[model samples]
Target: MNNNSSIDQSYTHLEIKIPLDPSANERLRSAVLSRLHELYGDPLPDAISDRVNAELDIFYNYFYSSLFLTYQKLVNCINGSGLPYYLFSSNGASLICYALGMTLVNPLPAHYRCASCRHTEFSNSADSSDCGLILPEKHCPLCGALMVSDGNDLPIEFFLGLRYDKTPYLALAVPHAMSDDAVSLLERSFSVTRKDPRDYKFPMEEGFIFAYLDIVPTDSDPESEMLWRSSSSAPSASSASLAPYEMTNARVFEYLSRPESFACYLPYRDDVQMIKSLLAADAVSVNNISDLSKICGLINSVNWFGFILPSLKSGAVDYRSTITCREDIFRTLVAHGLDSETSYRVMEMTRKGRAASILADNALRQQLLSHDISEDYLTSLVNIRYLPTRAHALELAMTVYRNASENVQG
Candidate 1:
């Protein structure tokens, strides 16, 4: 256990234990292999074997033993305590997670149970009518549970790949308030990194997962924004003047470099990560156009972010209001020679989803039209950016409610 006092006292005792150097990855490797053998039965299928090895390789190579260990400990903690949680993040797409009982979502070749007969398992594709996910799926003649499409249809590559890294969001769904005894146990079991002492609230960009929990109190000092922690981890001496949650140019660029898995509003805190990641990188591409593939495909995870602009009146950015505004730094991106396709899609999401007339300057639109950008091509970009950040919140809440109910039953 880390003997250092937690930055936040709310998480004083909890510590996560993991090996120092897991280069060998043998212990985890053996554990996962044994679990897979038990789940899929003996000599695993080729497709399954390939997928397992691929994910494990990444996990091992990155030295993400703590991540897996965290999941294992978290699940054990919740299940042993009889709490209910539904895993729904991209990390939930891993078969290893499901086998470990950390998730109920499955990522594998889609399979369906026959509704009428109940016993028939089909390897073949099921049309929309036969799909259980869409409706009263083909009613299993023999049973109902078998006819449903695997509860998840997401690509595993979306969650983790050889080229990627992720910060796991194990949002706690505490159903209700904990008894003092339960609270003690919970505190002794895990730790939360503190946001900053100035505000005591988490950076809203990170979605304030514990905003409702009152695990930390709000810092009421008015000059708190100008304050700085003198720790080595603090941004920089020059940035010491910025508010705890406010962004500096360096901070913005650094965060943009590695897009977070959850959309955080931390230049604000507590806003959904999905919402934050959407727009920043798409616009950043305007300047770094030559690295378009790396910027768009690899570096930035989502294209749904806007620049964290300064507040005009007070000259202080309010983290909460900054995120809710639809205005992005698109115009600025256009000023830097942003091309049509990326700009048009990003701009479409703002100001009522229209591309040209509303968000884009007419001069930029004319430049695009001069290049013969088509209306069809402009509209072809799909809006599939719906991720369930709220569901994570609710899952933790449900767990709390369940725990409360169990206590009542007991």
Candidate 2:
């Protein structure tokens, strides 16, 4: 950061107020200096100090204003609501963010130890996504309180470089709440814009950051009608001429671009965004998903999870049901990779109960959690059940089937 603030006659007025708080820059510096000293000893090596200072200056200058405050508010809201939020940006590579609690990923060296000698070593090796606590267990003779990883492999320079500020970071937040209640906290924050279905975008304001609020959908939401109406009203391009994912893509773009989140916008959860991600993915061909038109018709027209059951020969789904599953149609959904519990839920929805009960069954719900199914995915199913909007869910199902096919092919 240039210390010389020569007159900048061309500056815009700052509109948003940054809440009065301790300097994040100072906090980052203090933490970095202490960590460096621990690693390099009292008289820190000059080269390391220079590198650290340069990175911190860039970090402090850029974020200490708009980005920092915007994240602070959103993070605080997520924390207050007892929901999980994550930064999706490579800011994970910065020590300041890890120290500042902006990211859980540790950008530091991997910790290791020698089991025989009881000594400790910190170096990059087999690593986990969780950078801080992950360690390869070994011990050697050296007995220090800790070991530090050599960051040279992927240094701070890789993140800060000559121009880091040009990038805008994105974050995803998922919260658990009733169908009508999920967006209550987000509504409390400063909502800057509301999208319109006709594809409208307002100019971004100064003090605010853009947020794609995936608020829960409720029956009262007038915006919901827009999607159903638009999809039906648009001349469904002849199936032969329709681009893969085009309909789903247009619908999602319309949802986000429209000024809907102002008590009038956003989807029920991040699963919708996940659908967006799946459609945007480059590594996969959705050919199989296209082929399963019969299953898609069954799923979009009849049941959200049910159509895939018969094709899925797993014990969870009844084989007897496969006969009734309509194979003469050329293809059907084969539920794959899902555990017995999810398959069971599909079976239940197909045969006995409502999909909303999938989470209501505490035992099975816990099992799903135990299996580490994403909150976004599970919640999407629950909402789809309540929504009874098979067509919208079908868009997601197509993406899911496509992405799964790619993963298997890979």
Candidate 3:
């Protein structure tokens, strides 16, 4: 267990444990294999799966992703509250509290406890238990007016600062660069990167970054935009001082380079059914019964078969079954770009009526709707499920639709 003394004096311990779900490895592998086969028409050699799995295993074990995923899923589930997408950051949290106080609205459940104070309150009032939140209330008995929540209108900088705080985790930079970028003055520099922090794989711009940033600039902190972090452990540095738009553009550039990053956002719960349907369709496309028979054999076992060469249809295996085979799918959709026909098909197939799909379908539908998405882009998205999530696919569809719509209107 690792404990941090700085944040909580009460002593909070984070535990490390290996995932025992034997099925997770296979499920994850098959997920990847499905993408590879769809993209490249066959499973990658076992060596590649081994490499990717090693990276994935490490990421899967991190608390940040789990926490972020939980927060995202929860916020997406809320109804009719146009609270700008919830974000992580000391100040952003404050902004949310402020908005909650102003609107007398609660985005989270009544039972939700403050991560800092462990206080639970249904509405804004000082009499309520301290939720450890930065801004408890506008006129509360507890921590007073650095009272971040004024209800509703939070300064843009607050949200900007919040995303900046998450940069190290999602941005994955060289230690030397992180130091130069994250720390400005010499006084607190040693405190932030006391250990060999560069050796750790800190996440920066994963799928959530794109899904959220593409919609609400709340998640985006342009380095050029002067911003401040309220934390006392470090000297204040303005985001604008760091660079033009700061490191935001740089990180975004990095994320867009990897097609797989975009691909990862496609896994809405109902997407599994859509993919299964597509696979069945593709299976029929092969035409040669004997060839189809061989491909199915490989596809069915591709999740664990180790290596595959569509040219050879044979390979070695180092792990249990979970080989992915979705390369062709990505290649096809990405190549065609997002289109109206594909988007419509995707929305139709992944909708609520699908009984065979996962229960998480509603979440996926909500995510898609959040992005102002249309049908054609949805089709392109059904192909990129490696980093699949409810928000990412919908965002992509919306972006494509918005662009096309604007072009036509112009």
Give the top-scoring candidate (TM-score).
Answer: 1
The Cα error of candidate 3 at residue 20, in Å, is 10
- Whole-model lDDT per candidate: 0.36, 0.36, 0.26
Please rank every candidate by TM-score, starting with the best. Answer: 1, 2, 3
Q: Write the per-residue lDDT of candidate 3 for residues 82-190, one digit (tens) a residue.
A: 1212121222222122222211111221122222332323344443221112232333234222222212112222222212333211111111212233222211211
Off by more than 4 A, model 1: 1-24, 84-88, 112-122, 126-151, 179-183, 190-386, 389-410
Better of 2 and 3 by lDDT: 2
Query: Mind giving the per-residue lDDT tens digits that candidate 1 earns over 276-356?
Result: 343342323211111211222211112222223223123354332222211122332344466544453454343233443
Looking at model 3, residue 270 earns an lDDT score of 28
Candidate 2 segments whose C-alpha is farther than 4 A from its true place: 1-51, 63-66, 85-87, 111-135, 140-162, 173-183, 187-410
Provide the TM-score for each candidate, comma-separated: 0.43, 0.35, 0.18
Q: What lDDT tens digits, residue by residue, belong to model 2 across residues 1-410?
A: 00011211111111223433446566557766775565455454555456567667776666543445465566556545533222224344565554454543345544443323324345445443212232333334465333332221224533443256344333231222232232445555655333442222323555433433332222323443343223322333132123232223333332332222211212222233322332343211223322222222232222333433433434443322322221111111113344543453343353222546656788866665565555653553443321211122223333233222221211
